[model samples]
Target: MRLNLPSVVLFALAVSLCSSPSLFGAEASADEKQADWIQLFNGKDLSGWTPKIRGHEYGENYADTFRVRDGLLVVSYDGYQPSDLMSMDKKGKKGFDKFGHLFYEDTFSHYLLRVEYRFVGEQVENGPGWAIRNNGLMLHGQDPSLMTLNQKFPVSIEVQLLGGNGKDERSTLNLCTPGTNVVLKGNLFEPHCTSSTSKTFHGDQWVTVEVEVRGSEVVRHKVGGDVVLEYSKPQLDPRDPEAKPLIVDGKILLDHGTISIQSESAPTEFRKIELLPLDDK
Candidate 1:
């Protein structure tokens, strides 16, 4: 058999594409069952989501905070009125206090969520010093309707995604427990946040962050294909007065709840947010 150089190269490229999971979408080449994988975002509109932003009524988008543009789910603060702007430090530097979360209406246990996100544009004016390129996925979040109009964060486990500034090793898909606590291994892990083992992801490039959640039993964080962090037994923090109500029977186990994306003064875009249910029928 005689093979031309171009033909040989083409064959190799095709093989690489089949083996590549980062080509596009979340868990690009995962072992997901066809019927199990559900698309959360329709890539056209906010059909299945409800927005809750600070100072706005429940379901109010509060400045078109969550929008779909060109098949991407975008968290924007474009329509914020001047009165809505928070932290007016410098002229022309606009930051709004409308910390928001766009909640997926459904709740599920024992599922895997895969989201592809990238930071875009500048952070809103007067955004917290720690929220420049900060955005995240809130797992086991509280209901949007129950949240107060001024609540900063829901009682959930945050899969914190952050981008590098320029010369620092910042990691993505780290864990940030807001009003909650979790056991990292055999002992209880505290401090609100624990950095992941993944390398720093710089720039506005799209990054795939996946979470394998098996209720309060265990949860794993993965960046691309590498398993970066894993923890178990997520529970409401009794020490935090804000989360005390969620602790029932003197023991609060977060087995299931809603999922949401945060709008913490940063512009972020999610091109794909998909989930695969691991529960047996």
Candidate 2:
């Protein structure tokens, strides 16, 4: 039997469409079954998220501190109240602490997180004491309920993402063991640890930060494609006093937990937020 050209073309198109269910609905079902790359932000609204400012209740009231503008998560100063501002250098401008927190609703463990961030607006007041403007991404963070009303922040390993003027050169991916500490090499350091070296990026340009975390075994931080910093067995403790609590209490486990973005003192923007499970294979 002979087939017409138009009929054969139509049949081939139909077969191709049928084979690739992604063009319809089967792909979505397949995604639900596997460890897939999920977008934390739907690109339209912050529907699945709850925002908290400085440990306050999570709700829409804090929405002013964090907002979505032009498809980017913008941390701006527009939402802060005058009373909440802190004075530095005798300046009347309120500091960034008035709106210090911006957390995500869901948490995860053993996943790869990728984010692109850039500084926005002019340099402003930041840092604790004189450390410079400090912003961070907290992983393995526990429930907010674990904190006291007056508690500044809970114990979590922070991927310290910083940006600042040339004074201190503090722009590196450091590890801040908030209420915890980790063993490095053979010694125990303070709850705070800096990367071997600091890596800096353009102030306004978007920079990609990627982290691969698996339980408490190892955590890796990459910047612009280079492995800028890494630590292994972060749960282990040295004899350092700072690490003693983290070790004795056994809060170092990174297994599965929530992820959060910080709103330190300066204005920042997050353009892309995504995650993939390590078990996708």
* Maximum-TM-score candidate: 1
Error of 1 at 29 (Å): 8.6
| Alpha carbon deviation, residue 249, candidate 2 (Å) | 8.5
Please provide the root mean square deviation of candidate 1 (C-alpha atoms, Å).
8.2
lDDT of 2 at 78: 68
lDDT of 2 at 89: 36
Give candidate 1's TM-score.
Answer: 0.84
Give candidate 2 misplaced runs (Cα > 4 Å). 1-35, 60-63, 87-96, 123-133, 164-168, 196-198, 236-252
Task: Please list the Cα RMSD from the true structure of every candidate, rounded to 1 decimal place.
Answer: 8.2, 7.2
Go through the candidates in order and give the clash count of each: 2, 3
Candidate 1: worst 10 consecutive residues by lDDT?
24-33
Write candidate 1's Cα lDDT for 51-163 as tens digits. Answer: 88877788988778899999999988777666666545357565566688999989977898999999988887667778989988999887778787788888899999898
Tens digit of per-residue lDDT, candidate 2, span 166-256? 4445555678876555556555556466763646664566677888887766788887667777776555234433334444354554465
